[model samples]
Target: MTTLIVLPLLWRTRAPFTSLLCITVAGFVYLATDGPGQPLPYSPLVAIFTVAAQGGLRQRRFAIGLGLPLIAVSVAIRTNTAREYLFAFFLFTMVYVLGVLARTRQAYTEAVELRAAELEKARQAEAERAVERERARIAREMHDILSHAVSLMIVQAEAGPLVVRSDPERAEAAFDAIAGAGRDAMVQLRRMLGVLKDEPSAAGEPSTSRSPQPTLAGLEDLVGEVRRTGLPVTLAVEGRPRPLAPDVQVTVYRVVQEALTNVLRHAGATTVSVRLTWTPDDRLTVSVENDAADVPGPRVRPGPDTGGGRGLVGIRERAAAHGGTAAAGPGPGGRGYRVAVDLPVVVSSPTEVRR
Candidate 1:
């Protein structure tokens, strides 16, 4: 009979409720038949513990319902004393409570591990997004720098040979402009490449020793360089001047640069007008308009062979980055091309401005 009661415990993990029922019945038979004296009921306790630890709500309730009566009867069969009944009840209750604690601890551990895995996955996704954004930013900067430089060089190159035999000094100036543009492009490209280098500086930060970004003050130089191409260009700035963040300045400069490059490459214009209007509402509006050239070439968009479509797209991106807007279309009366951008000026503190 004792062997019968012990045998059902083998299925405790796989079929805990069935194991507990079998053990309970065998135990009742053991007690009723007046079997050999045993100090405690071991197999029933083990089966009840397994059911409480591994079984669901219904199975656990069944275990408890059946265990209470089985424990009472076993204790009553063993000794008709209050102390023995109390002790047996306390032992079974303690085992059930322990099994419940083990189950809760297992659930908590699994939950923590699952939460940690989710957080790690999210962190990796964010890291990949950051890399993609950085690549896009670098692509835009490269496009702006290269397009403006190449446009100026092309204009100067086309005119250099035409005037070389007839006008030596003008040809010399054209050659000089080409050289200047090439050198400027090279410098900018070198600076860009330097950012990718893994060499750390003395402060353990990436090396960032490069020239300062172009500002509104450099617009005069820009206009003069384009004027050397024999295309009449005018710049007009209105309203009170105010400080702007470095990023805002770069956005403004690139917008104007791309606009002028488009005028040179696409619009065969006689005269171009660049305007910077600072309104009283903390907004700056940039406008570039060109009149149709006296001898217009084939009407084609700029950078057709050299990634042209991105110019306007890039201008819009820059504007949108600063919570601004850009519009490009025909000038007044549809005479020529016009590009305009409106930017909200964000002033940064002195500490935020890089020297």
Candidate 2:
């Protein structure tokens, strides 16, 4: 009989209502058989606490209603004086308080656990986003390095013969520039591979670098090499130039590199102009223009917004990443193709402007 009242409590978590009902029925049976004159068993106390702790207010009330009546009957039949009834009522009240407190504590603990789980999920998502951004940056670096190197190399390779026949001295310089471009491209590729090697994968595997990233300072070497291809690419500067963040300068460098690569690969222009201007408001503006490619249609095409394209879309993404903007298309009067970019520079080095 005692087991019948308490055994149903095992279902309290999964089937709380059914467990409460079973406990109530067993309690009534115990009272009927034992008679109200007898002391109430400990089973009723356990059932009352379990129901109150496991259920909502409605369930707690139902269990309390059933138990209270039985408690009153037992006190009425067994007690000869008021003192016993008072003691029993005091004991029942304490147990009821204990159950309510336990329920509240349980709900609070569950709520905390739910919030913690949500925070962990959000943290993982943010980590994934950072990794994606880093990967995109690295991809742009490699594209600019390889595309510019290969395009210059191809042009010099083709022009090497003509220059050799007409002017031996210039021909040697062109060949040397081609070799330099090849070596530079190889060094950059190796550095990229090293970065990949250093980046530990999720599985804890290491990928396996030297050479600093390219910057605007390195453009002189680049322009000299491009000029070796028998093209007139002039550079101009306006406004005072300030030191920029390494990453910001890299973006500017790549925008120029990618744009020039487009000219070398697709544009049939002999004369191109590169311009750099610094605004009074902590910004750098870069533009490259060349006589239109002989081929019909635009030399550069639009790519997706996510970047990684060698076309105008990639330029837009790179600019937008740094809170900047870019535009590329046929120049005015249909005389040439032009690419222009505006990049923000939050950090500045010492004041210096190179002409």
Q: Candidate 2 overall Cα lDDT vs. reference?
A: 0.76
Residue pairs clashing, model 1: none
What's the lDDT for residue 181 in model 2?
92
Question: Which is the leading candidate under lDDT?
Answer: 1
- Candidate 2 residue runs with Cα over 4 Å from true position: 1-40, 65-70, 80-86, 199-210, 293-309, 348-353
Give lDDT tens digits, candidate 1, residues 26-130: 878877787887734788788878887899999999778877887787777778799998998998999899889888998999999999999999999999999
Top candidate (TM-score): 1
Clashes of each: 0, 4
How do the residues 140-207 of candidate 2 rate in per-residue lDDT, one tens digit apiece? 77778888887777777666776688989877877887899999899888788877768665687764
True lDDT of residue 43, candidate 1: 83
Instruction: List RMSD in Å for every model shown.
Output: 3.6, 5.3
